[model samples]
Target: MSRDATSSLAAQIDARLSAPGAMDAARFASFLGGQQRLGLTHGGRALCRHLRPYLIAEHDYAAVARAAERIAAALERVARRALVDAALAEELGLSADERALAALDPGEGPFLTVGRLDMLVTEGGFSFIEYNADSPAGITDQLLIEETLMALPHLAPLRRGRGVRAPAPHRALLCALREGYAAWGGREARPTIAIVDWKTAATSAEFNVLADLFSAEGHRALILDPDELELDGGRLSAGGERIDLVYRRVITQELVGRRGLDHPLVRAYRDRAAYVANSFRTKPLNKKAAFAVLSAPEFADLFSPEQRAAIAEHIPWTRRVRSGRTSWRGRDVDLLELIGAEQESFVLKPNDDYGGKGVLLGWQTPPDAWRAAVRDAEAQRAIVQERSRARTARMPTFRDGGVAEEEVYFDLCPFVFAGRMEGAMVRLSASAVSNVSAGGGVTGLLIVDDPRLKREDNRHV
Candidate 1:
């Protein structure tokens, strides 16, 4: 496409947002509600069933694919290193008992079984922040929302680019779940899938999405909050049904403690319930410290010289910040001074929190606030990471009384099922945090095939 054509397409989108007598947020909300109702009434549990699927922008796909390739290679290197370490630990008469326990699937292990990619894509390219190796949410939710969004009439014209196509996340998810079931000693009489999460509104919403997807796949899906489950004679029972496959969405650390060794849910999970997604092993990988394993001197041979150099350039420098522990003593001794010096370049993150909570972006807050946050971080098991500037794009949004401009960016979350990459969930957010709870809108991921748009040359706008 020519520059003029691209500009024209962008203008069309802008015009839609700035149309004469533009719709207000209240009207937009009403329209959205009506669409949701229509989906529920016509599609029978599917949201936004009236809209058609939109294709992923071809230029965006090239950028995403390139970034994914690099990240996948790095993950492969890291996984290989872990496997070698596990083998060596076993050979050297270390962790023998642990290995035996792992063989038994004792619900406690050091190795991770699944991984997730949280990334951002801009006109420049894609930047991956970290891998959610434990329990990444939004796979099923993304598909649900994507399917719903594509059915809306308002979004139909938005799919004008060459070979626009939304990736089928539902089909991809079903395949992954079935693969996990088959891997756990083949199919059974009836596959009983359990979606596990904490008993909270947010977690409940996630469970609802997964349950709906599982139902569509002809499986007996049970949504169970950990607190509601009971272990009766080594069987997991929730809502009067036994669980065979567990789609674990709860934090591994929290689940282990809540459903102790004796609970039926934990016992079933440990003994026979095939964890469809991430299992207990994901805990270590979810740790910020896991990235340290990538930079460790002991794992130097994991990557080729070129790949290693690329990794160093691409991955952010992450250091574990513990109370009273001087990570870099002689190099930088001025904690207070440095905290104020590079306020805009650092991010303080808690080790185990999600949905963008407990994240303090130094550049977004006041200097005094940044100092206070840094001091608190120093008091906790938090890590200070180098912040990469994520470029944002403008999206049309309806505010309370008028059409307003909203900052948006592409969140390309690739789902890795059973250690293999499958598909992605694209989330567009107005704020820096692209979480659904943050009121971000979602769209379908479409991959175009046009040769002109398929090339990497169009990455820059």
Candidate 2:
């Protein structure tokens, strides 16, 4: 589809969603209740229950697939090279533990398996803000919203006429785990699976959805907090049920190590007693500073031509917070000096965090506040990046029981499992910090197909 056509279709969807009696307070409340019924709650709060659906032109999804595939390839190249190429890993500024985790090798499938790249796509194209290559959230929350949207009466006509649809992210996750399990030598038709996470973590509620998905697929699924499981007598068991596959949702080694639970899982993982998808080795690539490595010219040779081009096109300028001189756009300059002089052109972020934690938007902050944020980022081992403005979508949603149409920033999260693109997690926020956990609401990712797309495809064929 042409750019104008895509824009027009998105407008039509937005208008329909905002149409009178399309979605009311009572209907929205029922949707929230449905989320609770599906276990889409984090910290006992209905996860993304208040947000409306995000529509995507199917052509845009295809473009996302092409870009995401390249990004995935680059990430895998970095993961693979970090293991054998010591010099490359050192340049990434990885901690000792991070280095080991990157080099430990999960043995099969993509090392950066089951990940998400948080990105912004506007008229020009999409550029990533951060990559959650380890333990990304919203896998089940998005699915729940999509299900509700598909069942709504107001959306019934649009769904049938426009070919509105969403892929099953949970189902893709299950398939990815089974592949990893078989690679680790699991022979059973239905392997017992455990969803591991902190007992009191906010995201624990999503575990029930995962458990149900596993069960529906003919496998035994158990939601076990890190402290509840143990490895003994040559078997890894949770609640006395033998665990054949571990879908790890917890990665904080210190917390799990304090109780000596990391020992069993790590040992079992190395000994192949059980399979752990996204095994402990994805820590380094999950860092915000990882993009710094990808964007640097020195590492260009490590990636293929296609990967390098995609990195340059879609990745913004990023560098770890430190006191030193560096090159920016081929010009040598003092890092802090450039940041201070061009404060509005940059954003600061903690290297390892989620839910928009420790993010400082330079464009939105005063000079004094921006300087203060820079000091904080330096103290916390964070990264200062070139700010990439996101395109806003008009979302017609309910606020205080009233119908309201507002321009909201949208972020597209494409999930990658075993190096393959699956369903996505799309979110909208009135603010630049478009994090679902931080009041940035989620929406059903609808692939709106049209005749123009099919015509273009036929010509290609």
In terms of TM-score, which candidate is strongest? Answer: 2
Lowest lDDT sum, 10 consecutive residues, model 1, at 41-50
Give model 2's TM-score versus the native structure: 0.91
Q: lDDT tens string, model 2, 1-461?
A: 13533566666656676677777889888877887787766666665543446666666677677778788778777766766777766655566766655555456654755998898875667787778876888888656775676567655565567366677788888888888788767888889988887787777778887788789889888888777777887788877789888888886444344654346776667666778877777766777777888887877887989888889888889988788998997899999889989988898988877889878888888899888777776767788888787778766667877667778888888888888888788887889888877877777776666665653341110
How does residue 46 of candidate 2 score in lDDT? 66
Sequence-dependent TM-score of model 1:
0.76
Candidate 2 regions exceeding 4 Å error are 1-20, 49-52, 102-105, 159-162, 253-262, 376-379, 454-461
Candidate 2 deviates by what RMSD?
A: 3.0
- Candidate 1: lDDT of 123? 43
* lDDT per residue as tens, model 1, 147-236: 345333455564454544555555665676676666666456458888777766354555665677788778888877777776676566
> Clashing residue pairs in candidate 2, if any?
none
